[model samples]
Target chain A: MVKVVFTDHAGSEQSVEVATGVSIMEAAVSNGISGIDADCGGSCSCATCHVYVDKAWLGKLDAMNPDEDAMLGLSTDRQDNSRLSCQIRLRDELDGIAVTTPEFQF
Target chain B: MSDSIVNEEIDRRPESKWSMVGKDPYSMPLEKIDLAHPGIWQENEFLPFLKRLREEAPVHYCAESATGPYWSVTKYKDIMEVDTSPHIYSSEPTIGIVDAYEQFTIPSFISMDPPKHDEQRRVVQGVVAPTNLKALEGLIRQRAQTILDGLPIGEEFDWVERVSIELTTQMLATLFDFPFEDRHKLTYWSDVATAIPGGGIIDNNEQRWAAMEDCLATFTRLWNERINAEPGNDLISMLAHGEATKNMPPMEYLGNILLLIVGGNDTTRNSITGGVLALNQFPEEYDKLRSDHSLIPNMVSEIIRWQTPLAYMRRTAKVDTVLNGQQIKKGEKVIMWYASGNQDDEVIENPERMIVDRPNARQHLSFGFGLHRCMGNRLAEMQLRIVWEEIMQRFERIEVVGEPERIYSSFVKGYAKMNVVLHPKKAA
Candidate 1:
């Protein structure tokens, strides 16, 4: 299981362990994470599944792609660490990843 | 109507990154886009991609010129979180997908924050509100029935053009209190503004740009004329005196008016076409629906879920944040794949299959979520529902004589020209 931390739109943080093969959006929704809304099932279409990658862990994760970049342009509160949770896949390297949720998304 | 391109000719398997025509974001392969032909999603690489994302990376990453590098969020529950929150992610920069921020101006309320967005939306909200729509239901039904009367049984026609565009455009004209004769212009302007996906159907960047600018100037002229004229019941009049809009300069208002044409056009057109196609695709569901019209609402939601008119919308990051285990920097863009979200296995059971009675169908992110949900959603639904109802009563079946064509752009998923053969109950 990968330990993931999420911060809600209200700036609340919750950490949980997600399975390695599962998407972060699934982990959050199944474990009751309040902020990550992956409205589109990882199609690189909708920007609802938004989250901020912890500053320290940015390098560990895979780089962002063009489709994600285009969709991310639609969000309400985008940040430096802001990433769509659906885009990031779970793995051992990201096992202890800590992320923050923005205060708002659209 | 069947789109023209034959699916059998393409690779039957899901398009792998390596197998894809172009691996990198910078070099866009136009060949991969079957502009003249529609792709069969049921058997295409797109559906499997959604399934894989659901089981694998609910939130996936994508790199492109618009946001450089960004994440794509998939899965139902996660999308809800984004939809519900508006303060964090934003759409103030642009609305059309695929295009960079420089290509388009700041969108209207469709991409704005609460206070400012709600202020502008209020003008039309009263006019297009569900309650107001209910008041216009009889009129809409009458008009719809009249249009249905014109369909030729077993003869081919472009449903996308005849039914979807004309009906919705007429309705939009009503909301704008526009002159009935000028309704076609609204559709034209919308098509131009929405050409952000590879610069529209013609693929001519310069021509589309010049045309759109000209159309925009005309809209500005008209908005000014209407606003300065009598206080009519249309959106233009409302905006002229509206609390949120009265103070704004003419350019912003012009931008918003142009925004309206796009906001109204692409979405409603795709919905109707999508609905009819969905019903045709599932003959059993169509039979069930035709036999029992009560399933129209659920079917409408399912159509919205299935079609997802505005394919993908974007949002920018405000600060440093982490998604899943990925590191994200400040001011980065994140794209949400609503199409994939709708098919998330974790959220909707057998999401790939369109179950008419799917309880969570409303959970789809087609109209978007949170602060920027499509303001014209009610109007869209009303029009679609009415269209399907009329179809159910008027036609025997909507046959697919030609292979349907898909939109060329990555942002919007729809048919530009779908040639369909309609078999009606009787000749009009």
Candidate 2:
């Protein structure tokens, strides 16, 4: 299991142990972490799962694609580190990664 | 006697190059029922055949000249994968199943990527905040009951055509702030927009253009009205007043309203009729529902799962990515089947069977997930639950007397017409 911390737009913290294979959105939802609604079930269409990954690990993981960039822009209060949690898979290197939720999912 | 006419395969074009069920696995004759004709599509096809396709390839792929034979992503897990991965997959190319013309751009923020998508959705969301959604609830419920109240006292009517459509239209009218008298136009326009080939729900392009033009004109009127008036809480009002983001242009507002129509209209209508159908097929389950009303919420989720209303939401790949060991190139279409994913055995037990209290009800992909999840989901459930409650109190028995039909649409999947004979309840 990978240990990850999730921070919301308000900066609330949710520390949980995520399985290696699950996506960041899955980990947050199954654990009952608030903020990420994920209405489309992780489809790129719905921006409900918008998150801002802690910049510490931004360099280690893949960069946001055009779709991801576009979706983040759709989110409320998106930061430069904004990323769709569903796009970030949990790998060993991403174990300490943290993500902050957006102000709104609509 | 209730009759059901279902056909998994609607109209087949001989030149179709894709085959999803057979030999090449990637190519199969396009086999899908038009959902507009609820009577025949549900009765003769849809369900039973969806089961067969599941058995063959949990992840079936097909093409119908729209997206040039894209992946179906049929299995529950696979569909979820497609839905979950926004960066790797997208909604750009073929927003849904129907392949529109190159120049034809629908202001479907749902299908757009972020920056722009976010601002537009934000504008709408602002209008539908919890407070707004709550206020609309009582009114919507009342509207639903009023429509039900008007149904034939003791006759089995076509629930989809009568109850569901009327209920949804009234709710939409509130959202659009259109006068209640013009409610039918909303239904008519929405129906024409989602009308598929199998059900003949739509007329030719001229007819479609006329209806769309009318809708556009009405929206223009609304926008101008809002622009003139100060911003209020309503969606159109909020959008008119809200500052457009750098990406969301002011011109796209009218088109965005149309997107809201399709997003809200077809999805709820299908879910409503699908809920009734699920109850009809699972009599024992329905009985359970009749006895314990609390399960209405779960039942709503199950119906959305069973119906999987909006069929395949198309996403284009923004970059080359590997899924299930397959190499997907950039700009390729990845059609996610939320309906198929809701039934994945891995995620839900006996995915085919409708479990009223299925503990993990959120697993279904009906509302979608990720950044682009459905905005009207909460209201949808509220409407469905109230509809069922009224049915339980007012109906003794409702059975299909004539064959049901389905929408020919590859996108919105639902019953176009379902005839039923309702045994009205006598005074307690």
Candidate 3:
């Protein structure tokens, strides 16, 4: 199992443990974490599951696919570290990765 | 104006069109069921036909209809697949079931493929983005209170006109920074944009073209005025200064303006009306809502699902592809029936009923999935949330007093007139 931490816009933090292969979105959703809508259910279509990965772990994640890049491009709050959580599958190396959720999902 | 006159008009029309209107969904051969007829939708008889399609043939083809030959995709998963895969199912030419006429065509991002779609959409999406909504919320709530407080308690009024149309039109005016007095023109142009010819709103294509011309002229004046001024926060100013859209041709500017106007207008207007009618239809759900006002946000999503305001979005097959074992030829029209997909029992439990706290209610397809998903979705949700919140504080119930009148098009599944009476909240 790997540990994932989610910090909401209000600065509340939630940590959850889940087996590898599940996406960070599924992890946050299953743990009843607020701020992650995941409206498209991980299709990378809806940008609702957006997150800002903690700067340290940003290099460890998979490269953003063109679809994810295009989707994030439409977000007004998008930052350099922004990523759609559904695109990031949990892996052994991603253990203890922390991210923050925006106040509202567009 | 009356049912008999409308029926006589349909009867007098050529039999070749609207042949499927009065036919039974089950008794008729499966191949004979045509879902595009505006008659079934306006009459609220489209559900049975959609159910039959989902049960028997999820990706059935209609060989004949008023529009032409087209494929109906009725399942939830299949819709997700087609919506996400824009390369296979292109949105170009036009998204409407009817083919586009060269003179009337307006170039908006909703019907365009990516690169260009991505560029133009980026320029204006921020106007309704969630951050901007936070600033607009207090104003929206203020407006809702004004509209609701003025309502006549215990007396009949058209909810569509009094509450739904009025609030949404006012909101659109604020979004565009449009002239407050002429805001009614925004609502009229939006209706005409999606109206079907020979339907109640318009008599023929020429009338629609004239209305479009007037809309274009009015907006052109707004654009010229805003383009030379300091950039403001409104949509017109944003478009006037937007890098991707600033140099666009007159028709494209009008197209994008009409897109925002209609997108911002008709959709939420109907949902506002639909929520009142749906709550009355399911009294138990209303009781649950009255007891716990905390459910407003979740209920907003459930309302959108139950309403599914815009019925379906048309996508043309970019290449010869097989979807759910049915081979769709290149350039054929494929209609994604979101109205059917929302009720597909496979994804939603008790798909027919309106459960206020229904789990994952936001997952519904009212805002079609993928690249072309409704950009103003967050704004729509915010408007509904504020309206309902203010409503609960003032009214015990907004009762649907009489039968609701529906719009004439199948594409826009919404109400035209719904008589309602408001019951004031009793003191604690």
Q: How do all models score by TM-score?
A: 0.70, 0.75, 0.96
Can you list each candidate's DockQ?
Answer: 0.05, 0.26, 0.83
RMSD of each: 13.0, 7.7, 3.8
Residue pairs with backbone overlap in model 3: none
**TM of chain B vs. native, candidate 2:** 0.85
Error of 3 at B149 (Å): 0.6
Displacement of residue B74 (Cα, Å) in model 3 is 0.6
Candidate 1 per-residue lDDT, tens place, B1-428, comes to 11221122222122422233223322434223221111223223455455555566666665532223456666766666655545566665655433332234534666666567766766655666554677778988888888888877677888888888889888888888777898898887777665532333434445455666676677666678976888776788778778778777754775778777777788888888887777778888887886788888778878888888765677765667666565656666666778777777766677666667777465677887544667677678788888888887777788866667666445657777677887766654
Task: Residues B207-268, candidate 2: write the lDDT tens digits.
Answer: 55567778878877877897788776667776777776323454365457767777778889
Among the numbered candidates, top DockQ falls to 3
**Which residue runs does candidate 2 get wrong by more than 4 Å?**
A1-106, B1-67, B100-104, B197-199, B245-251, B425-428
Q: Which tens-of-lDDT digit does each residue in B190-270 have in candidate 3?
A: 999888766788765567778888999998899999998999999999999999999999889988998898899999999
DockQ computed for model 3 against the true two-chain complex using alpha carbons = 0.83
lDDT to native, each model: 0.67, 0.68, 0.89
Q: lDDT of candidate 1 vs native?
A: 0.67
Off by over 4 Å in 3: B1-16, B102-104
